[model samples]
Target: MANDRRMTTDRFFGGVGERLENLQALFKFVDTTEPDKAELQDWLESNTAAKSESTIKAYVGFQRSVGLLELEKDQYQTTPRGATFADTGDPELIFEALLENVDGFETILQTLDNEQTTTTAIQASLREAYPEYQLPQAVVGRHLEWLQAIDAIEKQQSADRYELTSFGKRLLQEKLDQKPTIDDLEIGSTYDRVELHEAYGGARYRGIAPSADYPYVFLFTGDSGTEHGYKDEFRGDTFIYTGEGRTGDMEMTGGNKAIRDHKEDSCELHLFENNDEAWSVTYLGQFECVDWFEEQLPDTDGDHRKAIRFKLEPVANEVEFTDPDLGAVDTDELYERATGAARTDDEATQQTTVETTRTIYSRSEAVREYALRVADGVCQGCGDEAPFLGNDGEPYFEVHHLYRRSDGGPDHPDNVIALCPNCHRRVHHGKDGDAFNQELISRAENVESDSGK
Candidate 1:
């Protein structure tokens, strides 16, 4: 029972009022992962008043004692209560915890009582009030240090005395009245102002979707009202080909422009839900634009028009969400990083260009060459000869995928076909594109190897 009473005594890191602020700092330091004592000390030196190892030790001990942290081996991690306080940023809850645990810290506050006083004055007052206890000036200074650390009291700009902050006064009043306040409700977040308008029904902004030429962090809002309604069918992590519309000659502007510029190594994509709440713009991590092609899409007037469709692949990282600052990273280096290759100093300085390195699979080149050799200067789709010869003195027909690599298609010879440029465009954008694909599937060799036929 005696030890229990001692445990019940409230103690702050620096002294009475400062522990919560210290707790806040500690939580911020270990936002999602545990760190060692040296790391904590380093963070304190950079972010807080405590600079020495001794001061950080005291602060960490105080936090551990108050159930804010759990030390395992050499690392410190946040307790569930610590996480809650960090997420909510509720000062009152922190204060309540302190009041229940710390012993004589409240006496210091009661004595100061919202007055503008110096540490010298506080010491004299404490001495006068409790002459029998014989509290030292250092103890009084320590308490004042804590109060100041927590911003319960601040030094006046014109005078050398300390005064209570508005937050300090509200805290004191709420404790006295035993009343509670609520947290601010979240509105919309994540989507930019223009995205918000497009997401809602204010106005339809053309060229908003991400494209190959200028890959953007496009939102795949899986909602019923969306133009393509792909969101309803989207499941897990996979590639998507966008519905087409809004075309230009050799260039797509607006959303189409963004997609047109998307390079597999350079573009970025994000998925969000169509929850229609201000705060519901959840970040679904970054994705890679693997491939794109033009497809026929119906315009507003229901007429078929050429539109650019994009294929996206996910970037797997240890962190749950990463909001990369695209401008800070060189576009060339960004692609290199995306493709899992090291960029030398010279390569990083060069202008942004599409890289032809292996990313999803290394055998893609071998498969393409094998399929081209099998075609032997003839377009398999149209039974026509190659339109031209290449520098290698071979037919220049392109290897087309029966299934997209982004959509779990194998990079094998059987799943690929050689096509003339005209037939390639016809299969991707013609009115009978689906029928043409079915025809290829029936005749294409070796495609059934992975399908358990």
Candidate 2:
């Protein structure tokens, strides 16, 4: 039986020797010796049958893609797989241990039944089981699947669950009687690049490519010409052609012209445009420009005489731009205020300036607090105590703002309601609060009318 096993092992090893040889070449370069790209290229040229520099480079890239090599700072090093398992001092011994413990995967299956175990838990388990080996999760998952394919184990619904199969138990019993050989383990298969590319063709080729039609909001500023003669004084009237449209020429003719004619404090003009079906300009506003133009010039073009230059300059007034559907807002720093925690004189002065000029609020926290107050710390309809509780035993509740942020609802307490997490989730995503409230009102009216009848 031993001789029979030996012959099988020899056949398997001999058949796989060429593929393993290629992998061994990669392992040498990735070893702790840490050869840079040039050294690696030299080694590949001297050792491997690979003829061209491009082929060597391609092989090195393949090794990287397959987790056998990693590049850092132009130097190549063995990945965890190569350093710990594939080319180690006792690679066969380490591989045997992994194969023997295929049933050990039952622990993972058990862990998944209780809760979602993080990748960290699996790594910790591997470290405990094989203190000397550092196996990556990808390698572990691959081995797990191999065990399943051979009917040695079965996986449960949870990623961590595995059950030993009858074939696996029998294999373990047989291995106990005789020393295990490499033939006892399964050899992983490989494919050529063309085969792999063909296999993945459907997934790789099928998809929608994004086009420039995706709508995005942009701000445009008029060009600022050079300091040449009359151009410096007439710079205020130089209408910034925000590629968004020609409409800015007419819309800004009123208030903007006044500032340019009066030569009021250097001013900034804002224009909005849509680039969907057609380029259209929306609204325009002007504010006092408080900074030097030379510092704000865009890097794209030094020639400011162009129709429109995309440049942003510091201004005194605040401007808030918002996307209605996205519920995203961009605001100038005019709303940022200090928290009165300054200790130094300069900090104190800055704090005073900020406090006088800006206002700030924690919108989410405010909404949550308001919701708790409105619900009176209980379920509004069922009067059931909320499930979530604070450390102090206060019923845990979330705040729901009636008008959504996307619809321009203010984050004030008046627009908020206190609700349990379940109720809150239901209100937004389920029956919806407005419809539910109308149904409740209709039921109440029927009850009152029936009582009178």
After superposition, the stretches of candidate 1 with alpha carbons farther than 4 Å from their true spots are 1-25, 36-52, 118-121, 124-134, 158-160, 178-453
Per-residue error for 278 in candidate 2, Å, reads 30
**Alpha-carbon TM-score of each model against the true structure:** 0.31, 0.23
**Best by the TM-score measure:** 1
Q: How does residue 95 of candidate 1 score in lDDT?
A: 54
lDDT of 2 by residue, 1-453 (tens): 000001001111112225354555557656746889888877766766666777677656655654557899988887666676555543333234333223234333333333444555755664443332455676466545444544555666666556556665655455445532222211122123222222211111111111011111113221221221111111111222222112221222222222232224222232222212222222232222322222122222333332222222212222221223211222211112111122579866876666344333233332344345446768754557788778967887755555543234344444455556676656545767678544434544564488662
User: Mind giving the per-residue lDDT tens digits that candidate 1 earns over 1-453?
Assistant: 001111122234444446566667669678676888888778777766676677678767766776677788988888777788877766655555554444334445655575777767766665433322355666666555655655666777686577777877766666546422111212222445344333221112222343211224354443432344221222112345454333232235444444445454355554444446543444444555556676566544455566556655455421110224322434334333433445577755652464433323223434455567668778999999999998978788877777643334444456678899898888877899989987987877434555543
C-alpha local distance difference test of each model: 0.54, 0.39
> Candidate 2 local accuracy as lDDT?
0.39
lDDT of 1 at 278: 40
